[model samples]
Target: MEEKSFLDRMLGHLRETCKYYTGYPKYLGPSRVIHFTSEREFVQLLHQGYPVVVAFTIRGNYTKHLDRVLEEAAAEFYPHVKVLRVECPKYPGFCITRQRKEYPFIEIFHSPEQAANQGRVADPNITKYSVKVLPFNYDQSAYGFREFFKRHGIRSSPDPK
Candidate 1:
Protein backbone atom coordinates (compact mmCIF):
# COMPACT_ATOMS: atom_id res chain seq x y z
CA MET A 1 0.00 0.00 0.00
CA GLU A 2 1.15 3.53 -0.73
CA GLU A 3 0.22 6.74 1.01
CA LYS A 4 -1.69 9.27 -1.06
CA SER A 5 0.05 12.60 -1.47
CA PHE A 6 -1.40 15.59 0.41
CA LEU A 7 -2.59 17.30 -2.77
CA ASP A 8 -4.34 14.13 -3.91
CA ARG A 9 -5.86 13.69 -0.48
CA MET A 10 -7.15 17.24 -0.31
CA LEU A 11 -8.64 17.07 -3.80
CA GLY A 12 -10.30 13.79 -2.94
CA HIS A 13 -11.87 15.34 0.14
CA LEU A 14 -13.13 18.38 -1.75
CA ARG A 15 -14.40 16.23 -4.64
CA GLU A 16 -16.77 14.42 -2.34
CA THR A 17 -17.70 17.51 -0.30
CA CYS A 18 -19.88 19.05 -3.02
CA LYS A 19 -23.04 18.47 -4.99
CA TYR A 20 -24.23 15.45 -6.97
CA TYR A 21 -27.03 15.25 -9.44
CA THR A 22 -28.72 12.32 -11.18
CA GLY A 23 -28.73 11.80 -14.96
CA TYR A 24 -25.17 13.05 -15.18
CA PRO A 25 -22.00 11.03 -15.24
CA LYS A 26 -19.26 11.70 -12.69
CA TYR A 27 -16.98 14.47 -13.86
CA LEU A 28 -13.37 13.35 -14.33
CA GLY A 29 -11.74 16.57 -13.23
CA PRO A 30 -9.54 17.80 -10.41
CA SER A 31 -12.13 20.24 -9.09
CA ARG A 32 -15.78 19.58 -8.35
CA VAL A 33 -18.85 21.68 -9.08
CA ILE A 34 -20.55 22.84 -5.92
CA HIS A 35 -23.85 24.48 -5.05
CA PHE A 36 -24.08 28.08 -3.96
CA THR A 37 -25.70 27.91 -0.54
CA SER A 38 -25.52 31.46 0.71
CA GLU A 39 -23.60 34.69 0.83
CA ARG A 40 -21.65 33.13 3.64
CA GLU A 41 -20.64 30.29 1.35
CA PHE A 42 -19.59 32.80 -1.30
CA VAL A 43 -17.45 34.58 1.27
CA GLN A 44 -16.12 31.23 2.44
CA LEU A 45 -14.93 30.35 -1.08
CA LEU A 46 -13.09 33.67 -1.14
CA HIS A 47 -11.62 33.01 2.28
CA GLN A 48 -10.65 29.50 1.14
CA GLY A 49 -8.64 30.91 -1.77
CA TYR A 50 -10.76 29.48 -4.60
CA PRO A 51 -12.14 31.78 -7.28
CA VAL A 52 -15.87 31.08 -7.64
CA VAL A 53 -18.30 31.23 -10.56
CA VAL A 54 -21.95 31.21 -9.67
CA ALA A 55 -24.61 30.28 -12.22
CA PHE A 56 -28.12 31.40 -11.52
CA THR A 57 -30.54 29.14 -13.33
CA ILE A 58 -34.07 27.87 -13.59
CA ARG A 59 -35.90 25.06 -15.41
CA GLY A 60 -35.82 26.93 -18.67
CA ASN A 61 -35.49 24.95 -21.89
CA TYR A 62 -31.92 26.04 -22.38
CA THR A 63 -30.73 25.60 -18.81
CA LYS A 64 -29.91 21.89 -18.80
CA HIS A 65 -27.58 22.16 -21.76
CA LEU A 66 -26.23 25.39 -20.37
CA ASP A 67 -25.38 23.72 -17.06
CA ARG A 68 -23.79 20.75 -18.78
CA VAL A 69 -21.45 22.97 -20.74
CA LEU A 70 -20.63 25.03 -17.70
CA GLU A 71 -19.79 21.93 -15.67
CA GLU A 72 -17.69 20.53 -18.48
CA ALA A 73 -15.69 23.73 -18.71
CA ALA A 74 -15.21 23.87 -14.96
CA ALA A 75 -13.87 20.34 -15.09
CA GLU A 76 -11.47 21.35 -17.81
CA PHE A 77 -10.14 24.11 -15.56
CA TYR A 78 -10.42 22.14 -12.37
CA PRO A 79 -8.67 23.02 -9.09
CA HIS A 80 -7.93 26.49 -10.40
CA VAL A 81 -11.59 27.49 -10.62
CA LYS A 82 -14.70 26.37 -8.77
CA VAL A 83 -18.19 26.53 -10.30
CA LEU A 84 -21.34 26.84 -8.20
CA ARG A 85 -24.84 26.43 -9.61
CA VAL A 86 -27.60 28.51 -8.09
CA GLU A 87 -31.27 27.70 -8.70
CA CYS A 88 -32.85 31.11 -8.77
CA PRO A 89 -36.22 29.71 -7.77
CA LYS A 90 -34.83 28.83 -4.38
CA TYR A 91 -33.29 32.26 -3.96
CA PRO A 92 -34.83 34.68 -6.40
CA GLY A 93 -33.70 37.60 -4.31
CA PHE A 94 -30.15 36.40 -4.57
CA CYS A 95 -30.21 36.70 -8.37
CA ILE A 96 -32.49 39.73 -8.42
CA THR A 97 -30.27 41.75 -6.14
CA ARG A 98 -27.43 41.16 -8.56
CA GLN A 99 -29.73 42.08 -11.48
CA ARG A 100 -29.46 38.63 -13.02
CA LYS A 101 -33.03 38.34 -14.25
CA GLU A 102 -32.33 36.12 -17.20
CA TYR A 103 -32.05 32.40 -16.80
CA PRO A 104 -28.63 30.81 -16.76
CA PHE A 105 -27.00 34.02 -15.61
CA ILE A 106 -23.35 33.59 -14.76
CA GLU A 107 -21.42 35.71 -12.28
CA ILE A 108 -17.72 35.52 -11.53
CA PHE A 109 -16.28 36.73 -8.26
CA HIS A 110 -12.66 37.45 -7.48
CA SER A 111 -10.53 35.32 -5.19
CA PRO A 112 -8.54 36.75 -2.32
CA GLU A 113 -5.43 36.04 -4.36
CA GLN A 114 -6.56 38.27 -7.22
CA ALA A 115 -7.99 40.82 -4.83
CA ALA A 116 -4.66 41.09 -3.02
CA ASN A 117 -2.53 41.30 -6.17
CA GLN A 118 -4.87 43.84 -7.79
CA GLY A 119 -5.17 46.14 -4.76
CA ARG A 120 -8.94 45.71 -4.91
CA VAL A 121 -9.57 45.67 -1.18
CA ALA A 122 -7.86 48.87 -0.17
CA ASP A 123 -11.09 49.74 1.55
CA PRO A 124 -13.63 46.99 2.29
CA ASN A 125 -16.22 49.63 3.12
CA ILE A 126 -16.63 50.60 -0.51
CA THR A 127 -18.14 48.10 -2.92
CA LYS A 128 -16.73 47.66 -6.40
CA TYR A 129 -17.68 45.97 -9.65
CA SER A 130 -15.47 43.09 -8.75
CA VAL A 131 -18.08 40.67 -9.99
CA LYS A 132 -18.18 39.89 -13.71
CA VAL A 133 -21.64 39.17 -15.02
CA LEU A 134 -21.77 37.24 -18.24
CA PRO A 135 -24.10 38.46 -20.95
CA PHE A 136 -27.52 36.83 -21.19
CA ASN A 137 -26.43 35.38 -24.50
CA TYR A 138 -23.42 33.81 -22.84
CA ASP A 139 -22.02 30.73 -24.46
CA GLN A 140 -22.47 27.36 -22.78
CA SER A 141 -19.75 25.45 -24.57
CA ALA A 142 -16.39 24.53 -23.08
CA TYR A 143 -14.50 26.46 -25.75
CA GLY A 144 -16.74 29.46 -25.29
CA PHE A 145 -16.40 29.37 -21.53
CA ARG A 146 -12.64 29.01 -21.90
CA GLU A 147 -12.55 32.14 -24.03
CA PHE A 148 -14.70 33.96 -21.51
CA PHE A 149 -12.38 33.00 -18.68
CA LYS A 150 -9.34 34.01 -20.64
CA ARG A 151 -10.81 37.42 -21.45
CA HIS A 152 -11.64 38.02 -17.79
CA GLY A 153 -8.17 37.08 -16.41
CA ILE A 154 -9.10 33.56 -15.34
CA ARG A 155 -6.87 30.79 -16.61
CA SER A 156 -8.19 27.59 -18.13
CA SER A 157 -5.18 25.77 -16.74
CA PRO A 158 -2.13 26.23 -14.54
CA ASP A 159 0.96 28.09 -15.68
CA PRO A 160 3.99 26.34 -17.03
CA LYS A 161 7.34 26.41 -15.24
Candidate 2:
Protein backbone atom coordinates (compact mmCIF):
# COMPACT_ATOMS: atom_id res chain seq x y z
CA MET A 1 0.00 0.00 0.00
CA GLU A 2 1.17 3.54 -0.76
CA GLU A 3 1.85 5.94 2.10
CA LYS A 4 -0.42 8.94 2.65
CA SER A 5 0.80 12.29 1.32
CA PHE A 6 1.89 14.98 3.78
CA LEU A 7 -1.14 17.12 2.93
CA ASP A 8 -3.37 14.12 3.53
CA ARG A 9 -1.66 13.48 6.82
CA MET A 10 -2.04 17.12 7.87
CA LEU A 11 -5.66 17.32 6.81
CA GLY A 12 -6.42 14.10 8.60
CA HIS A 13 -4.66 15.35 11.65
CA LEU A 14 -6.66 18.59 11.53
CA ARG A 15 -9.94 16.73 11.14
CA GLU A 16 -9.14 14.80 14.25
CA THR A 17 -7.94 17.77 16.32
CA CYS A 18 -10.20 20.77 15.59
CA LYS A 19 -13.90 21.56 15.53
CA TYR A 20 -15.05 24.12 12.96
CA TYR A 21 -17.72 26.53 14.08
CA THR A 22 -19.86 28.87 12.01
CA GLY A 23 -20.31 31.68 14.58
CA TYR A 24 -19.62 32.75 18.13
CA PRO A 25 -21.66 34.43 20.84
CA LYS A 26 -22.25 38.19 20.60
CA TYR A 27 -20.56 38.94 23.91
CA LEU A 28 -17.50 37.12 22.70
CA GLY A 29 -17.39 39.83 19.99
CA PRO A 30 -16.84 38.00 16.70
CA SER A 31 -15.98 34.56 15.45
CA ARG A 32 -12.70 34.05 13.69
CA VAL A 33 -12.43 31.04 11.46
CA ILE A 34 -9.59 28.81 12.58
CA HIS A 35 -7.67 26.75 10.07
CA PHE A 36 -5.36 24.32 11.78
CA THR A 37 -4.16 22.64 8.61
CA SER A 38 -2.78 25.73 6.90
CA GLU A 39 -0.37 28.45 8.00
CA ARG A 40 -2.38 31.13 6.16
CA GLU A 41 -5.37 30.39 8.38
CA PHE A 42 -3.22 30.75 11.45
CA VAL A 43 -1.93 34.15 10.27
CA GLN A 44 -5.49 35.28 9.57
CA LEU A 45 -6.54 34.30 13.07
CA LEU A 46 -3.67 36.39 14.45
CA HIS A 47 -4.73 39.48 12.49
CA GLN A 48 -8.44 39.18 13.37
CA GLY A 49 -8.05 40.20 17.02
CA TYR A 50 -7.93 36.62 18.15
CA PRO A 51 -4.92 35.05 19.80
CA VAL A 52 -4.07 31.59 18.59
CA VAL A 53 -2.76 29.04 21.05
CA VAL A 54 -1.28 25.97 19.48
CA ALA A 55 -1.26 23.02 21.83
CA PHE A 56 1.33 20.48 20.73
CA THR A 57 0.38 16.86 21.29
CA ILE A 58 0.81 13.44 19.74
CA ARG A 59 -1.64 10.67 18.84
CA GLY A 60 -1.07 7.32 17.19
CA ASN A 61 -2.42 7.55 13.62
CA TYR A 62 -5.42 9.72 14.67
CA THR A 63 -6.28 12.77 16.86
CA LYS A 64 -9.91 12.61 18.03
CA HIS A 65 -9.27 13.14 21.73
CA LEU A 66 -7.44 16.43 21.23
CA ASP A 67 -10.18 17.67 18.92
CA ARG A 68 -12.83 16.98 21.52
CA VAL A 69 -11.09 19.16 24.08
CA LEU A 70 -10.58 22.05 21.67
CA GLU A 71 -14.19 21.81 20.50
CA GLU A 72 -15.53 21.88 24.01
CA ALA A 73 -13.53 25.02 24.77
CA ALA A 74 -14.58 26.65 21.53
CA ALA A 75 -18.22 25.97 22.25
CA GLU A 76 -17.95 27.49 25.72
CA PHE A 77 -16.25 30.65 24.46
CA TYR A 78 -16.96 30.77 20.72
CA PRO A 79 -14.79 33.66 19.44
CA HIS A 80 -12.55 35.30 22.02
CA VAL A 81 -9.71 32.89 21.24
CA LYS A 82 -8.73 29.93 19.14
CA VAL A 83 -6.94 26.77 20.20
CA LEU A 84 -5.26 24.28 17.91
CA ARG A 85 -3.62 20.99 18.87
CA VAL A 86 -0.74 20.01 16.59
CA GLU A 87 0.35 16.39 16.30
CA CYS A 88 4.10 16.01 16.33
CA PRO A 89 5.84 13.08 14.74
CA LYS A 90 7.70 10.82 17.12
CA TYR A 91 11.34 11.46 16.22
CA PRO A 92 14.55 12.77 17.74
CA GLY A 93 14.59 15.74 15.34
CA PHE A 94 11.46 16.94 17.09
CA CYS A 95 13.63 18.02 19.98
CA ILE A 96 16.65 19.36 18.06
CA THR A 97 14.87 21.48 15.42
CA ARG A 98 14.46 25.11 16.38
CA GLN A 99 11.57 26.82 14.70
CA ARG A 100 12.80 30.07 16.30
CA LYS A 101 16.13 30.86 17.93
CA GLU A 102 15.13 29.99 21.47
CA TYR A 103 12.05 27.86 20.86
CA PRO A 104 12.92 24.38 19.69
CA PHE A 105 9.57 22.92 18.69
CA ILE A 106 8.05 20.46 16.29
CA GLU A 107 5.52 22.92 14.91
CA ILE A 108 6.72 24.24 11.55
CA PHE A 109 5.41 27.77 11.90
CA HIS A 110 5.85 29.65 15.15
CA SER A 111 5.07 33.38 15.42
CA PRO A 112 7.83 34.01 17.92
CA GLU A 113 10.26 32.59 15.38
CA GLN A 114 9.12 35.09 12.76
CA ALA A 115 9.42 37.92 15.26
CA ALA A 116 12.82 36.70 16.39
CA ASN A 117 14.13 36.54 12.83
CA GLN A 118 12.83 39.97 11.73
CA GLY A 119 14.50 41.57 14.70
CA ARG A 120 17.48 40.31 16.65
CA VAL A 121 15.28 39.93 19.69
CA ALA A 122 14.81 36.97 21.96
CA ASP A 123 12.79 36.38 25.08
CA PRO A 124 15.26 35.56 27.82
CA ASN A 125 12.66 33.85 29.96
CA ILE A 126 12.05 30.39 28.52
CA THR A 127 9.76 29.07 31.22
CA LYS A 128 7.05 31.36 29.90
CA TYR A 129 6.36 28.74 27.25
CA SER A 130 7.83 25.56 28.63
CA VAL A 131 5.70 22.52 27.80
CA LYS A 132 6.41 19.05 28.99
CA VAL A 133 7.72 16.56 26.50
CA LEU A 134 5.19 13.77 26.72
CA PRO A 135 5.63 10.31 25.31
CA PHE A 136 4.11 9.53 21.93
CA ASN A 137 1.21 7.77 23.62
CA TYR A 138 0.71 10.06 26.62
CA ASP A 139 -2.23 12.30 25.80
CA GLN A 140 -2.19 14.75 28.72
CA SER A 141 0.18 17.64 29.32
CA ALA A 142 2.14 18.02 32.53
CA TYR A 143 -0.05 21.02 33.30
CA GLY A 144 -3.77 21.25 32.90
CA PHE A 145 -3.82 23.73 30.02
CA ARG A 146 -7.19 25.34 30.72
CA GLU A 147 -6.24 25.87 34.32
CA PHE A 148 -2.81 27.19 33.36
CA PHE A 149 -4.40 29.81 31.12
CA LYS A 150 -6.80 30.75 33.87
CA ARG A 151 -3.93 31.15 36.31
CA HIS A 152 -2.23 33.40 33.78
CA GLY A 153 -5.39 35.59 33.58
CA ILE A 154 -6.35 34.38 30.16
CA ARG A 155 -10.07 33.85 29.86
CA SER A 156 -11.99 31.52 27.62
CA SER A 157 -14.51 34.26 26.84
CA PRO A 158 -14.95 37.94 27.57
CA ASP A 159 -16.50 38.82 30.91
CA PRO A 160 -20.19 39.49 31.06
CA LYS A 161 -21.32 43.09 31.23
Q: Quick one: best lDDT, which candidate?
A: 1
lDDT of 1 at 61: 76
Which stretches in model 2 have alpha-carbon errors above 4 Å? 1-35, 57-62, 87-145
Which digits, one per residue and each the tens of the lDDT, describe model 2 over residues 27-131?
222333243565455556555554455555455433455555455655455566565554445432432342433221222121222232334337554312222
Candidate 1 clashing pairs, residues 3+ apart or interchain: none
The C-alpha stretches of model 1 lying farther than 4 A from their native spots are 1-31, 111-138
Q: All candidates' lDDT scores?
A: 0.68, 0.44
| TM-score per candidate, chains pooled | 0.64, 0.42
Model 1 TM-score is 0.64
- Candidate maximizing TM-score: 1
